[model samples]
Target chain A: MDNLKIEGTKQTPEIDFNSSTGILSISGRSIPENTFEFFNPVLLWLDEFSSIAPEKVIAKINLEYFNTSSSKYILEILKRLRIILKDGKDILVEWYYEEDDEEMMETGEDYEDVSGLPFEIISIDDE
Target chain B: MAKQSIYQSEIENLEESKNFLKKSDYSKLELQMEFKKLVENYEELIDQVKIITKISDRLQKKLNKTNIALEDSNIKLADLNDQLNETIDQLTEAKIGRKAATIVMIVAIALFIVSEAFIEPIIDNMFPNNFLVGLGLKLVVAILIKPGEDFTNKYMLKKARKEQLRESQLSHNNKP
Candidate 1:
């Protein structure tokens, strides 16, 4: 499987998925103009990755901000992770938020509850 | 949506499901098992969609805030830039006035020196002991001092105003 790497922008986040390392990371703000178009490819790649089924898949999501459409896509990403979880694979979702960002922390909790997946809600120092 | 449009999609979904009842012959027990399984899958999909919609909405709000902050910063930056340009223009005007004053003072001093050294001696010889010509020449420059400064000030101000007006007009036209 080829590694997936996407650069971050003012309106979008960065995506760095390493096939060899089994560590997928998405960080930065995500407020793309068209959420569906931006995330469709990323979802497809994850689907392909799930088939190969890496020994341990770790997904780290650290987002400062994201728009409504981007939020929907994020849920889709977590849903994909749930599928991998069903395949008897070890899946870890580490959700990082700013220390002072209570809203982001709450948002993470919502995802954790709904996905029914083990999610680690971590806080980092504010920038 | 209109009444017909609301039923359109639901009717389509039911029609597709009806195909199973039309062509397939199944035992009563088999039909019950299949219906239960179909309901289970649909319930799961609906739950997943619900979660996705909730989370996605929150993220979108955050994104909108970031955009608002960026716009506010841009407005502040434009205001500061306008203030800086105004100060620079005032400073330029002050500098021009200082230079004009220095030039005028230098010319007045040179005239006084020439009148005292050479013109006074020649005039005294011609008029036979008259110091009035020397006094008159000094008075002319002294009288002209204020007018000379006024001319310089008026000229510099006109030039500055012309340039400033063009800049202000250009900026106003571009203002959002």
Candidate 2:
């Protein structure tokens, strides 16, 4: 149950998953050259985390942009969280977008509809 | 172990199913099982297609928004650059004008001193009684002052432009 921490890059997002606190946060752009390679480890980690997950898990996602392939992997992540919810775990997704980014806000709404996870779509000022 | 790509796995599965159908030696029960597996794969593929299409379209919208923002930033940068160049041009002209004025004034002073030291004696020897001749010489120097200033101004302006161009080219080359 070690924490998962990845530094953000120009083309990839940062990943900070704290098992102890049950606060999983991902932020920044995600346009990796190998989407599968980049996300496969994340999936593996989630698979392990499912059994040992805390009483409450909060996933904070603040993505500026992501490619189509990354979108699939995002769904896969949500699917894992859905499995946790099925196990009677309390979980929620906090989807953050910039104030002016209508597209991002709508995309968050779409994920909320499809993933069946309680989502809070929050808008923040541009940095 | 390296996992197979999604498309590769799908293609391999489809090929295997096709081969299974082509083989005529399969029993009825075996054929039904194989068909069932194929149907299952087909359904999963349809589900993947549904999600991928929706996500792809939404991501495309996000990309379009980013592209528009980038274009707007570029336009603003270009406008600011134009304003900066205009200011540089005005400053260069002002500097050149001052330098030209200084050179003309220095030349006029030198000419005045030389006239008193050499040209006045020469005038005395040639036309000592002719005040008009001395007046004409002074008038000639006064007339040349304007053209001298004009030449100096043009030369300085050209040099300033060349230096500015070289500096801009160097900056362009240095940019990543």
Who wins the lDDT comparison? 2
Q: Report the lDDT tens digits of candidate 1 across residue range A41-125.
A: 7887888888886889889999988766566677678878899899988999999999977768888998898888889999999
**Proportion of the native interface contacts kept in model 1:** 0.35
Q: With candidate 2 superimposed using the best TM-score fit, by how many Å does residue A35's alpha carbon deviate from the native?
A: 1.0
RMSD values for the candidates in order, in angstroms, are 6.1, 3.2
In terms of TM-score, which candidate is strongest?
A: 2
What TM-score does structure 2 among the candidates reach? 0.87
CAPRI level of candidate 2: acceptable
Candidate 2 fraction of reference contacts recovered: 0.38
- List iRMS for all predictions: 8.9, 3.0
Task: Please list the residue runs of candidate 1 whose C-alpha ends up more than 4 Å from where it truly belongs after superposition.
Answer: A9-12, A33-37, B1-53, B71-75, B113-134, B160-176
In model 2, the Cα lDDT at residue A117 comes to 99
How accurate locally is residue B145 in candidate 2, as Cα lDDT from 0 to 100? 95
Instruction: Give the winner by DockQ.
Output: 2
